[model samples]
Target: MQLVLEKRAERSGTIALVSPLLAIGLTIVTMVILFAILGKNPLLALHAYFIAPLTDGYSLQEIAVKATPLVMIAIGLSLCYLANAWNIGAEGQFLIGAVAGSWIAVRTQGTDAGAWVLPAMLVLAAAAGALYALIPAICKVKFGASEILTSLMLVYVADLFLDYLVRGPWRDPHGFNFPTTAEFDPVATVPLLIEGGRLHLGSIIALLVVAAAAILLARTIKGFEIRVVGAAPRAARFGGFNANQLIILTFAVSGALAGLAGIIEVAGPVGHLQPGISPGYGFTAIIVAFLGRLNPVGILIAGLFLALTFIGGEQAQIAMKIPLDVTKVFQGILLFYVLACDSLILYRFKLVSSNRQVPRGAG
Candidate 1:
């Protein structure tokens, strides 16, 4: 029994080191099979999905576009996960932030708010997101509510609220009955970092946030407390770590980053508030955070990789005549392998003898 337990511990450690690589490998293999089932050459599909995106500047830019919000949201999520706080309402926070930021942008039209307008909108977005996140945080702290359910349910509420606004009060009168707001003025737009590239300043902000989060998690007292709180709540409490404060702080930070991502998305690539502005970046970032093992730097790279999948999916649809749902399948497969690999990281499989040992046991 002791030997078996020792072996299992070693196996778990080994799996922790190899799980990420295994997940990636499995994702690739699954995609190959999917392409074959679709009656397309797997090689050609692979090229379209992976290699083709890197062969040109435009496609690379699109990858950045998709990765920007993902990185931002995932960075915040890393913090929440570290504190062992489950904040599943990033989607709602994102939507609310977009709404708030766009409201400021639209209201400031015909005025010379200049550079301050964009900054103000961003601030509003962050605040809106944080406030939205506080609802669940407060409930959890005061009433012992399950944050997962509350946060997730709020996402639908935020989505419906946005839908109502765009279709009702905030509808563009000149949009030909479209469910979108007016085009944002230039003052409300997020500036591009490169003159000829689709990459925007938001990418720079994301990198900065990543660096900041890493530093916070690695070098700060608060970071130590967060780790302690997650690793051993009883010890953390004994050490005087305030659980309520950590919970609120974690949610606030997560919501703020998500809000920032939402507004930047609308002001940058999106350029207007639409009924469905996000392509589920909020939800996808949860996967990114976990796939990265909840590490800030890891989340950054994982976000880029997932962004590649999105770009590749679009390319596969256009070039290979594959359905868009294929991309979702790829994501689903990736998630499955990631979770399976994670399980192996903490558990070991044992093969037991099927045959009865009656003679050996003297039964």
Candidate 2:
């Protein structure tokens, strides 16, 4: 017996659309099994994980807050992915942005830096992220390096660097020796959308990013170049597109977005530049990008959905004694199923029977 996967003559749009949903369903099933194995009521756990988070105003607000960074980062990632440029170091870019933006905030601390401070921080963060991202892109273009390895490795470097800053130079001297910077001044902070509410300008910015991405992908020549280069590199090259240039462009864009997201996270919810500012938003955006099928509007929806998981994970940990690591496990499984299902978009599995050799000699 033999099994094979044969490429289809045409890609299945249906499967492409359905794959993420299938992955989500499979992940839920797996979670139920996991709950059962842990001696917890699967139904109750499921309720906590999915239903409980939506039942209150506070949880809803938190979900939106969490989704902001996810949506923003995923939008940039989608652009890079569309151009066949793998920018896996978005986590590093995110950290670098936070650091760069915080530099301004730290300097302006206790000084009347005016409203320009926040805008300046955001711009610096975005620029810093772009520069950080270009490192891997340039290396790939100039030295034939694998971006996947370089980008991912840089994440730890960024993490360690951030750790050093908070524990060393940027440390709040009066913060009881904690490894964190002083809280950002009002001028450096992102304004809240509602007084005393979690909703902030960052959420609005995230929405704008989604809208802009949707327009760019739907109605721009550069967007067409990205799609063409990714889908058919040979054709794109024949049409005078430079793949290396596209790689650099997409990486820089993705990095800038990631950086913007990082600073918003610090200036908005975190209120300071700290070591643990991100709950892996940079990494989680990869799931958002794929779950949304690399579509801008789709990414917005996917970001909200994944944001639910973050809240649900917290609720589950408190209500059911479930470990927080389970959320990471769920995400990993979901990503696996998503990639697996995507295979069906371009190929189908077939089982073939092999004739017995003895049949030719005796039968």
Report lDDT per candidate: 0.88, 0.94
In order of appearance, the predictions have TM-scores of 0.93, 0.96
What overall lDDT, based on C-alpha atoms, would model 2 receive against the true structure?
A: 0.94
Q: For model 2, how does the per-residue alpha-carbon lDDT over 127-158 read when each residue is reduced to its tens digit?
A: 99999999999999999999999999999999
Q: Lowest-scoring 10 consecutive residues by lDDT in candidate 2?
A: 354-363
Query: Runs in model 1 with CA error above 4 Å?
Result: 1-7, 10-14, 354-363
RMSD to true structure for each model, in Å = 3.5, 2.8
The local lDDT score (0 to 100) that residue 331 gets in candidate 2 is 84
